[model samples]
Target: MKMLRIISYAGLVAVAIMLLVAMCAILEDSVISHRAHRQELTGSTLSSPGLDHFS
Candidate 1:
């Protein structure tokens, strides 16, 4: 019983960490896209900024 409880706790912790990492990655992607949009509007970086530029 004791070992099972420890394993369950570890599993939960691992899942939580994975979720946190995924969330951060998504947020980073959005931030990068937003910045690219801003640069496009300002016309400072590329004249023809397309979808490929963001990715």
Candidate 2:
């Protein structure tokens, strides 16, 4: 019974660590995607000549 308890605790710890790592990976991906989208939008606006006249 003691060994079973130790194993269960270890498993829970491992799962928690895995969840933390997964969350970090998702956050990094979203940040990178947002930056890319912003760059594209900026590039498009800069390339247009009439944008300054409208603003």
Best by TM-score: 1
Error of 2 at 42 (Å): 0.4
Clashes of each: 0, 0
Where in model 2 is the C-alpha error above 4 Å?
A: 44-55
State in Å the error of residue 26, model 2: 0.3
Best prediction by lDDT: 1
> Candidate 2, residues 1-55: lDDT per residue as tens digits?
9999999999999999999999999988987776567658787534345433322
